[model samples]
Target: MKLRLIIIFVILAVPNAWAGSQSQAEPQHEPAEIIKFAKDVEKYAASKGARAFIIARMGRPEKDLPDGIMFTHTAIAVYSNITLNSGEVLQGYAIHNLYQTAGSPDKSELVVDYPVDFFWGAHELKAGIVIPDTQLQQKLIALIAAGNDQALHNPKYSVIANPFNSQFQNCTEYTLDLINAAIYDTLDIARLKANAAAHFSPQRVNTSRVKLMFGSMLMDDVTTKDHKGKVYTTTFTTIGKYLQKNQLADEFLTLNSKGEIQSL
Candidate 1:
């Protein structure tokens, strides 16, 4: 029952608009399929001579979300040409994502770590990969190096964040902001927000009013606000659409639990 309630909370926590990892003490192992998918991302980037890619996975399903909307999390993966002491060029990758801290519901941290850690605990092994062009990839690398990505983060996480508003942010929003910054003059947050909303508008999901109220009341970060009127939230779907429309993505892939790849 407790688990059910938690799922309920996560599922209904959003309305429309809105809205990482690492290692430590003991080494944690991700599922075999996820690891394989990560490897595939690295290999694909290297093969295309691409500098960066975006990856998202299907987390556990939320009952409150509309059917067929499955992706729950997204992150950016960047490839670096590591020159070893032997002068051999080895490609190394760093994945970045924003995660909420355990101590406080409102506090979140930007995590930079390995690709393997990015897909940990995914409900299914499925993933969406977006490879941006060389110039855009260079811009993405700059953002990661200068910590400009942090500027785009909104600690106030919401299930359905208003893509047009700056008050809240989620993983997808962070990723979108990075892309926007790289593509346009990201120094101005107002322009970036406007561009993002123009390319992609969040979609609304229909749920019981009681569940919506319960979610807003029970969850510290969840709220109806203007979202109830807008009736939509941004997720991987919106992000994918923006990428596709802009012609920014060099390659896109969908991988299943068995590690099969299909062009999305």
Candidate 2:
């Protein structure tokens, strides 16, 4: 049901490829409210003096999913102190997201981009923010510097990836595993997978059986395991629950389309 919407995100992830098809596809102009929301979010992070932040947004409207689940995607933002060639130090941020490479649609890779660039053309201006403690923030930076961030990725991109198993993974599932790695200071696949499943359970969206069957048939990587005749999939909201359960987030907030901030 949401297959077409997912393809839109894949197109946005690969701007170079999107450019080729821009004429025929008729790219939508980003809303002014969304741009304001992204800018204000960056400002809010700077004011908090956070080392890194977790961000979630409404990717698109998926009616098949359960109600009250507005957020569809998640990513990580890290603040860095860079020293230029001229010996000048500057503060900057980089957002990391899991995306399917344009050249190889079957493969998933980490995409590092500026905050505004990351949020460009988001379906909704609303977002949820998470600021980790100083200790965890440093760990996250170290993990990225060591090039260990790639260890948590599962090349196969599955929309209904089972969080308890490592057979396949989705964006939010990968983010949860990365957080688990930083928290334990270990990239052990077994440990990260177990912790993620314990702290975060997949959200059970009441999707129609027919739609679920269609998803399994259309998406080669997607599967609807017959576990007690039920289906489970990870979402941004599930990641929020895990952070709160483990107290991994020091501060959390929600930014709305109206340019208002609400602390969580």
Candidate 3:
């Protein structure tokens, strides 16, 4: 009976980390509150004059997340001229994401959304923000503008994907790929992976092996085949560390629901 309960807990809890793009079926907060917070995040980024930056959202409650994992969904947000419903063009930030397909957690698609839409289904109103150095920022903008972001995308999705290979990719890993592509100025994924293996420090997943094994058995997106030893995957915090270590970031901080900024 204890083993059965453990399996059931794994089935229920594991997917929260593995499937970062899954949205809550119902709104957790009021629409007005969500929209206000999203705009606040945008305002903060704009104040920093960020042309392109890394953004993260909390898709699950803080207490439920595993150690070393701060945020769930990470993506790139580029400043752009957006066309609205009434054919009006306005300058704002557009987010690029790797969201798991509805009803297909194992598959993913690249999606571009605005701040309001990006945070609409968030489980928490907090955000993780990282603005790259000016030169790298320009490179990121150019890469996305030139449509190279799609070139680096791998639709083979995994929650705990190995960053040292091309077998599987999660949202944070994809963000890292884009950053490396910008740094190296090449779309060569092989070279990118090699560089990552050499320089990047992925977040180690701190969870029981038994739970992970059962999660792999029960969930399509929770497989550990790509990982050989201890499970390590790219995360928002790790990305910040990489950029800060190499002097690629101008700012790395967290934006709370109260519009306060705290350096990470």
- Best candidate, TM-score: 3
Taking the tens digit of each residue's C-alpha lDDT, what string does model 1 give over 96-182? Answer: 877655655445678776666666665555677777777788898997789788778878776656777777776777778888888
Error of 3 at 218 (Å): 0.5
TM-score for each model: 0.80, 0.79, 0.96
Between prediction 1 and prediction 3, the one with superior lDDT is 3
Q: Show how many residue pairs clash in every candidate, following the order shown.
A: 11, 0, 0
lDDT of 1 at 88: 100
Identify the runs in model 3 with alpha carbons over 4 angstroms from their true place.
1-3, 12-18, 23-25
Deviation of model 1 at 180, angstroms: 0.9
Compute the lDDT of residue 227 as modeled in candidate 3: 85
TM-score, cand. 2 vs. native: 0.79
Estimate the lDDT of model 1. Answer: 0.67
Residue lDDT tens for model 2, 1-264: 597887554433321111110001111335565456677888888888877878876555334224646565677888876566899987777877786555554456777766566556455567778888788888888888788888788877665667777877767778877888889889888887787656677777566555655555554444566233666766666666667667777877788767687766
Give the clashing pairs for model 3: none
**Whole-model Cα lDDT per candidate?**
0.67, 0.66, 0.88
The ten-residue window of minimal lDDT in model 2 covers 15-24
Cα distance off (Å), candidate 3, residue 98: 0.6
Candidate 1 vs candidate 2: which has greater lDDT?
1
Best-matching candidate per lDDT: 3
